[model samples]
Target: MRSLFFFAPLLRPHVKRFALALLLALVTLVAGTALLGVSGWFLTATALAGAVSFNLFAPSATVRGLSFIRILARYFEKLVGHNATLKLLSTIRQWLFGALFPRLPLPDRSLRHGDLVSRLTADVDALDEIVLLAIGPLIAALVLGGAMTAILFALLPEAGWIYLSSLLAAAIALPALLIGVTRGTGAALVEAAASLRAHVLDAIAGQDDIVLFGRKDHTAIRFAEAGETLSRLRRRQAFATSLAAAAVTALTGLAFLATLYFGLSAFQAGTLSGPILAGLVFGVMGSFEATNAIIRSVGKLGEASASAERLHAIATLPSAIREPLRPVALPEGTGIAFEGVSFAYPDGETVLDGIDLTIAPGEHIAIGGPSGAGKSTLLALLLRLRDPQHGRIAIAGADIRDVGLADLHARVALLSQDSPVFFDTVRNNLSLARPEATDAELFAALKTARLDDTIRALPRGLDTVIGETGTTLSTGQLRRLCLARTLLAPAAIVALDEPTAGLDRETELAFLNDLPQALANRTVILVTHAALPPELALRTLTLAHGKLEATV
Candidate 1:
């Protein structure tokens, strides 16, 4: 319901355009109905005269002119409608991205890659059809229906009553059944399709890993299930939509039969002129034809509702992290303090509890712990990736939560366990850390990571495409590259996660030894399993469960 309300404002800017287009549609509807009535009258009049209708050429020419005007108005309506849809889609997507995402804190990737893309494209497209095609036409149909009833009544009151009754029945009943079923099916179909997209994309993206792990068959089975689910939903929706259309078509036929039978009776009684009877039947039926458009318009709303729900689901998450409205500044040289901080991931046992620690400015703090001992969690708190449920963390004299994330993030740079890489040139990958960095500054950091020589040997050198996730580079090399990028930034605090976790003795030592020089005056927090360089850290601590224990 919020989603529907949110979208209402999107139409305001383009209201004028929609208004003009609707006017054009009304003009076209009137002209088309007039043509149908006039054509029928011409035949009936000829029959009555027992000769060519008086002034046949003049009537034909006038009818032709009206039709030509109607054709142009129809074209104009279509043109404006398309433009309005595109504009509405752009505006709505902008809202979904800008207003929604910040409130949703997805610490981990929840949506599948392709499904995420589909949300931006296919989902929006579905809603676009509903907003432009469905909403606009429904309004036009109601207006046209009233006008058509008036025209029919003016010619033949009984016939007008019959046509209006049939039209109302078809218009209400068909959509109530079709779109009623459509609302549930559209959401289910969209969910199944999104699941399918996400599943297939994950399969493809993780194909190598799956094959390596020998889980290909299991993955394949899940993927097939996803495909089948989507297909079944779509098939069910199609069947229901068709059934409603058939009902509408059947009613339409009954209305036409009634008009024919009654017209013959009225003519025989000499209560109705043949020409007037013809005009009433044609004009009334012509207006009722828009019932088809009404059903189509109404059907799409169901799909749009489903799409809106999906978007709202992601948008209205219980955000784990919140930014300050007015932020305080971090102190110079980054003294870090964690004051009895406690936290746990949502729906999980406590990951960190009663954690208290402090690191003076320019100090190298090496944290060591067994796997799942909350060493990483402590680092997370410092970076404010995960906020504390209890206590406070501070940068010098100010609480970390008091500072806005944008400012806080700029002060501290963290290199996590996963050294993620993009499918891009090496230069741009490094630039992700600092987009405005100079080539010389980038090269200097690469040199410190011992990657400068390796990059120089590449075919494209610094500009070489690394493929997605830097497939061209080995794992250790990717880590070094990421480290280099993070090192390039002039953050007040630099935190490295298991910097030497997978590297060999030689490379690991080289990196560890150079890290201090690379960081210079910045406070360093290193999360490692092994002993850190004694010269770098003045004090060492171990994390067991969630407590921080100091050791000599």
Candidate 2:
């Protein structure tokens, strides 16, 4: 519950809309109760008059007026309330995305892709009930219940205490009890639903592997288990809600009977009129309407609370890397230096140890090694994706840590081993590297990566929309497409990790042969196990056992 309050600041801008909705809702309930009371009074008095010189003008007009007001107020209340809730939801999504950007490359891998999607979509959606369902209805119940109690006191004091006690029990006690009973079930339901979604996504993503390994049946069984867990929790929560609602219904009946008993005693004592007694009894029935909504919303309160806690956990995680307090400007050259750099993972597995190296501006260097040699770790360090455990990495005599990450990244572009070809147009994918690049420049990069001719033959050329992960393209073509994007960046340095991964030997050699001309005057750091052509004039180094050694 306290976690839910963490987002209160986001509600400030939309408070007016919510407040107006609340006002209309209160008016709707008041008019409804008044309508019932007035109609009863008017009917009873008419029956008693029996054509005796009775003036039915005022009561009849009021009954008609209250009914009309009730209808209009209810309509506007729904309109305003839903509109405000949607706008609030939009703001929350924007805010969540904004909060999410700087925390990229989250350190916690326990949060699967599908689970993260659930938090961003479903969990954020559950918060809508905070205003429209829970808070609004609870306030309406309090105000209406209090007003009804006061009227009973003024007109028939004997029933006032009875009505107030029943109102408190129905409006406050039962709802509280419902929240307590369903709290754990509601939380379990959220987790169960998220787990089910994760299972479905995993199955879809790994269907090919599951089939190859003959584990399709196992996967299907797992999905069924997740579904069953979600269904059972939902049933449990529904049962709790129904029980509370039944309790409220029984209490309402008892309150009515007790109120009637006192009203009758007062009437027999000649203290109460028949018409007034009927009106009060009818109003008592109408006042309990507010509690119905309260009871329903109480069941969702626990779900909302759990969702809030989940969202808060993700948003508050400490960033993997922090920006410098007072950043220094990057110097003029691209000369790189790694001075006494050492790094180890959280489990104390050293990947790089006391590495020291330097390269002059415009140097083309290749580091070749077996897998798990920490070649990619070196690149990540250079890009400031992770800070080194010890020592400094400098470019042009400026410590990379002392410069702004954005500025440092702007100067050094990386094409990682797993660089993705987004589900978008070839033009849009290339534009990610340089949004303002002209079509001619885009074509130049593609041609350098040896992919221009293939793209030119596509149905829409640069306007073609590619499938997710570039499924429409061949593996080698997708790799080249990503390479084209990296080469298109306007950085002074280019870092390529396994650039020739999916290419044929002929294409790989051709790409390496064209590399020097394609990246003229820019420093290049290439990490791959591919053999370099002798004529390329590139310096080579090898990494083994947490150390770098120059190749003979």
Regions of candidate 2 where Cα sits further than 4 Å from its true position:
46-68, 421-428, 435-481, 500-514, 529-537
lDDT of 1 by residue, 432-470 (tens): 998998889888889888799899899988899998978
Task: List runs of model 1 lying over 4 Å from the truth.
Answer: 20-35, 38-78, 107-123, 201-221, 265-280, 324-327, 368-371, 417-490, 498-514, 528-544, 547-552
User: Quick one: best TM-score, which candidate?
Assistant: 2
Candidate 2 lDDT by residue in tens digits, 418-490:
8888889999999999999999999999998889999999999998999988987887788778878988888
Candidate 2, residue 549: lDDT: 92
Give the lowest summed-lDDT range of ten residues in model 2.
100-109
Q: What is the C-alpha RMSD of each candidate to the true structure, in Å?
A: 4.4, 3.2
What Cα-based lDDT does every candidate model obtain? 0.78, 0.88
